[model samples]
Target: MKIALNGRPLTDQTKAAIQALLGELARRGAEVQINDAYGQTLQEWGVMHPFTSLYTSRADLFDADFVFSIGGDGTLLETVTHVGERRLPIVGVNTGRLGFLATIKPEEIAQTLDWLENGNYSLDERVLLHVENDRDVFEGTNFGLNDFVVTKTDRSSMIVVHTWLDGEFLNSYWADGLVISTPTGSTGYCLSVGGPVVLPRTNNFIIAPISPHNLNVRPIVVNDSSRIEVRVESRSKNCLISLDSRSKVVDDSIRFTVRKEKFGAQLVKVKGDTFLETLRSKLNWGLDIRN
Candidate 1:
């Protein structure tokens, strides 16, 4: 088996865990390949073993049987983008807080690996959002595993967003910003703005307003297949549009249309781990530790 490794700098504990994992893989005669950025970090650690190869492009990711993300859920999200339609499985080693995507714990690494090696796992395909800025207001078109946001910057005036669904005018929103999210992203920024926690497999789209000026205006949920168009009308010359973590300045005159992409991201889940389990663990649901 071949595994592709990518992540942020590992801590001492994480480094030890990685070393142990690599040793076990080596014992099983599996090859270890590091991503270009991570390969450099490994050299700084003074490891003498040679990496199978250093990968900087998505094409290199297709060769691996699995991609191991060593940081947090963010790293796993970044890694998932590299797989594209290849259906490459992701194995995340959580090193950060609130790891909804990176559910595997450092202490459970060995047991998890044992199960993975023994072919004990299932997959969950998460939908992705496609953003089209028809006016070329932002940079090259990008994809988001989370949500896309159009928000007012430091400007004092609130922005007005004219929204439409399937060619039917919805409502003009007066707020700081707006977010259109997939079911996978509903738990993120959407949740912060009073949006519901949509099931991962639900065919739904969540439209939530950010600090709407009117108390009567609230978040709305629509079909994922619905074509939603938004035009920003802000007093300021500059507003912000973000796809996941990537953002750029855009003129208020520009319009954005968002919908479900033709393809979705294939996420590799460990055997028997369900989305509800992740929500319960990450959100501390049903936990009563206070005394």
Candidate 2:
């Protein structure tokens, strides 16, 4: 099988796990294509491998059986941009704090790979928000697996975001920022700001204000079919716009519209590893904390 690999710098513990995984894949005669930056990092850390090729960009990627994202959720997000519309089933190995997306364990890499080869996994397709703006930033890849965010720049006062749902006036948000979160991302920024934790397949978008001036403003859940648009009025004449981990600073003149992307991200889930189980473990749910 062919495998494409991408990752971030390794931790002291995960380094050894990566070495073992590479050796196992080589022994199994699997073809490996690694990201150039990650390959450099591995070489620096003395993790040798029999690599078929190095992928510097999305153009270097071909049809592979799987894409291994070996780091935190940010690395997985970067891998998504690399895979782009090809939408390879991604397996994320967490080596960062609070890994909301990258759930696979490093030690279980060998077993999980075997499971994948034997068709013992399922694919979870997730929604991504697409951004349209007057400025040609983001280089044509304008979708994110998480949420679309607009926040005031550092030291800037709170901004006013005039929002509309499918051309109808929604609300004028007088807040530090606004978040348009997908159900798959309900556990991310939305949850941090008192938004509801929604199931991944709900196909709904949550509009949550960040530190609103009016305390009565609450998060609103809207159907994914609706198009959401926002116009910013900032004292600094600038605001920060983010699609997942990627962000840019732009002026208020840029018209912004966010909608569900045409294609979705594909996450690989091994049998027995369910989302409910992940929540129970990751969030420490159902654990007794009483002393």
Candidate 3:
């Protein structure tokens, strides 16, 4: 079986962890490969194995049986973009704080990997978003497993966003920004911006305003099939549109339409792990009150 490892740079502990994982895979006789960005980090650690290959392009991962995301949720998001529509299952190993998406703890790496080899796992399918802009910022179309956000940049003033749902006008939001998050991303920036947490398998989407001018404009949830449109009108030169972590600059005259993609991303979950279990453990969702 082939497994591709991807992670973030600028951290020494992550570098060591990758080396140890690569060594373990070799001992188990499983073929291993590293994303080019991470391969450089491995070489810097002075670890080399004949069974390992370095990925040079997206084509290198087409045949991978599994993709191991070895960092925080951000790195996992990055790995998703690289996976595109290949639908390869991914296992996120958390090496950063607030690992909602990167659910596997670092200490349980060996056990989790063992489950993978023994087929003791579940493949959870998560929804993805399709984002398009009237302006020619993106070459074609883009997809995000996490979310699509339209925000005012650091120097930009608060913008007015006119929204429509399934061809019906929703409301005009005057705020710092707005977020259209997937069920997978509801716990992320969406939560920070007052959006409710949604189950990973829920067929819903959320429109959460970021610091809205009116207190009555609460975050709204809608069916995934709804076609949503957002028109940005800012006093500044441009506005910021982000699909997951990738962003593009667009003129104020641009309009964004976001909806669910035809397919979803498949994530590898080890046996006996549940999404709510992670929530209670990670977020202390039901912890007792104490001073």
Cα lDDT tens digits for candidate 1, 123-151: 67888888887665434436778898999
Task: Estimate every model's Cα lDDT from 0 to 1.
Answer: 0.81, 0.90, 0.84
**Backbone N/Cα/C clashes per model:** 0, 0, 0
| Poorest lDDT segment (10 consecutive residues) of candidate 2 | 92-101
User: Per-residue lDDT of 40-91 in model 2, one digit per residue for the tens?
Assistant: 9999999998889999988889788899998888899889989888989999
Q: Which stretches in model 3 have alpha-carbon errors above 4 Å? A: 49-51, 134-141, 154-156, 289-291
Give the C-alpha miss distance for residue 96 in model 3, angstroms.
1.5
The per-prediction CA RMSD against the true structure, in angstroms, equals 2.3, 1.5, 2.0
lDDT of 1 at 164: 97
Candidate with better lDDT, 1 vs 2: 2
Model 2 residue runs over 4 Å out of place are 289-291
Q: If ranked by lDDT, best first, what sequence of candidates would result?
A: 2, 3, 1
Kindly state the number of residue pairs that clash in model 3.
0
